[model samples]
Target: MADGRVERGNQTRRAVLARTVDIASVDGLEGLSLGKIATDLGLSKSGVFALFGSKEDLQIATVRAARAVFVERVVQPVQDEPAGLAKVWRLCESWLGYSGRRVFPGGCFFYSVSAEFDSRPGPVHDEIARIRGDWARYIERLLDEARLAGGFREAADPADVRQLAFEVMAMMELANAHSVLHGEAMDYERAARGILTRLRAATAAPEELPERPPAFDFTAGRPSA
Candidate 1:
């Protein structure tokens, strides 16, 4: 009986987080309320509240859950590839694929929430900022590894890698924003082209990359979120 109760509680927590992440993506973290969530999912209000304790707690948990999904959908797939300029391309391509596929209703989960809580100083803002920073660092790390491996220019140092990573990420975020706001898929193609151009310019091994970016999925219509 105790085991069954624990399992049920675990399932409920997962269910709540799953709903919260999607809702937060579309409506922003501030849009979430335990009462509304419970009502929407047909769960007891008291039980939902008990699981999350407070609104802030629920938002934080939602961010964490979304991060897990992001890793599974984007980061892990290219993780085993040999570290080089090609791997860098693979990472960007994976990220574009995730956004292109509309893994979340609102597009990139962090992109939506970051705009909402960027100026607000709170636990939620801090959590989002931390994760965003981690992503930047990871990209820089990949670029530096490529440089060390002779895939990128040997003259490029940490600073250059940092700048390159920022530019690359900027292109991607623009694509995500354009897709979410304009409901057009052209930005994905634009981002891919921009990414390839930048990588090709930065690489020491010209033959390591393709002459052009692979085709992006352009069939997705405007996002409802």
Candidate 2:
């Protein structure tokens, strides 16, 4: 009986965090309140507070929740693909898809929350920075893997590949903004083409490279969140 009660509590906490992440994605984390989240989820404010302790705790928890969603949606899918240039390309596609699909309703969760906490210094900011740093490192690791697989030119520098990863990040964020503000799906295609061009330039065997995948079509319907 005690185990059942503990399991129920854990489930409720997960439910709260899921909703909290969505709300934080749309409105900055600063906009979150225990009372508001409790009301939205039909739970008691005290119950919510009991789980998170304070607003900062809740904000940090929300960021953690978002990171889980990001990994499931963006990272794991590409990891399932074979490593090398293909994996790297798919990683770029999945990221664009994640943002284009509006998985968080307000666009990329990290991009939105990072902008909010970037200038602020605290646990929340630190957590966001850690997430960003970890992602950058992941990109670099994929580039290194591709290099070992003979995907890139023998002369390509790891530092240069890391820089290319940063360019891909910039294009993705720009695509997200353009899609959100102007509703231009073409921005996603442009970003994909730009990434493809960059990758092709680094290709060790241009003729042996796989054909590029079609750009995501946002006009049809949003991908499942």
Candidate 3:
């Protein structure tokens, strides 16, 4: 009986988390109230609270759930591919797809929460920072691998590539925000093109770059102060 109850509890927890992530992505993490989640899932307030003792716990769990979803839908697909340029391509395509497909109703979960919580210091903010740093490091490592292979110029710095990767991600997030606001997919396509163009330029030998549509340069960053 105890085991059965525990199993049921675990199932309920997962269901709540899955739904919570989607809600938190579309609505800010603070907007993810127990009342709203329970209403969405037809679960009782007490039941939701039982799973997560407090809103902070729920926020942390939601972040973890979103990360798992991202890894499954975005990272795992690329991991199976051989490392170097191919892996980097796969990774980029997967990331764009992950955002474009709306795995969460609002686009990228991290993008939503990071902006919401970046300036606010707390456990939730800390989690967002850690996730962002982890992703940047992952991109840096991938860039390092591609550079070690014949994919990138020996003169290219991994840090520069990482910065480029961050720019691409920022572009996607900016596009997503504008799309959500204006109800159009053009920005998503534009962001994808921007990413691919920079990636090809960075990775391909100068002689090997194919003629394609012109790319936007987000790596230009903020204007000099």
* Best model per lDDT: 1
- lDDT of the candidates, in the order given: 0.90, 0.84, 0.76
Q: Could you arrange the candidates by TM-score from highest to lowest?
A: 1, 2, 3
76-136 per-residue lDDT for model 2 (tens digits): 9869666577678778888888888788888888899999999999999999999999998
Which candidate, 1 or 3, would have the higher lDDT against the true structure? 1
Model 1 lDDT-worst window of ten = 216-225
Alpha-carbon RMSD, candidate 1? 3.2
Clash-forming residue pairs, model 3 = none
lDDT of 3 by residue, 1-225 (tens): 999999999998999998889888888898889988888889999999999999999999999889999998888877866556556655766676677667788888898999899899999899889988898788778877777776775567767777776786677678878866786666766776776677777765544443343332222311112
Runs of candidate 3 exceeding 4 Å displacement: 204-225
- Which consecutive 10 residues in model 3 have the weakest lDDT in total? 216-225
- Extract clashing residue pairs from model 2: none
Selected candidate, larger TM-score, 1 vs 3? 1
Quote the positional error of residue 88 for candidate 3 in Å.
1.8
lDDT of 1 at 216: 69
Q: Against the hidden reference, what TM-scores do the models get?
A: 0.95, 0.93, 0.85
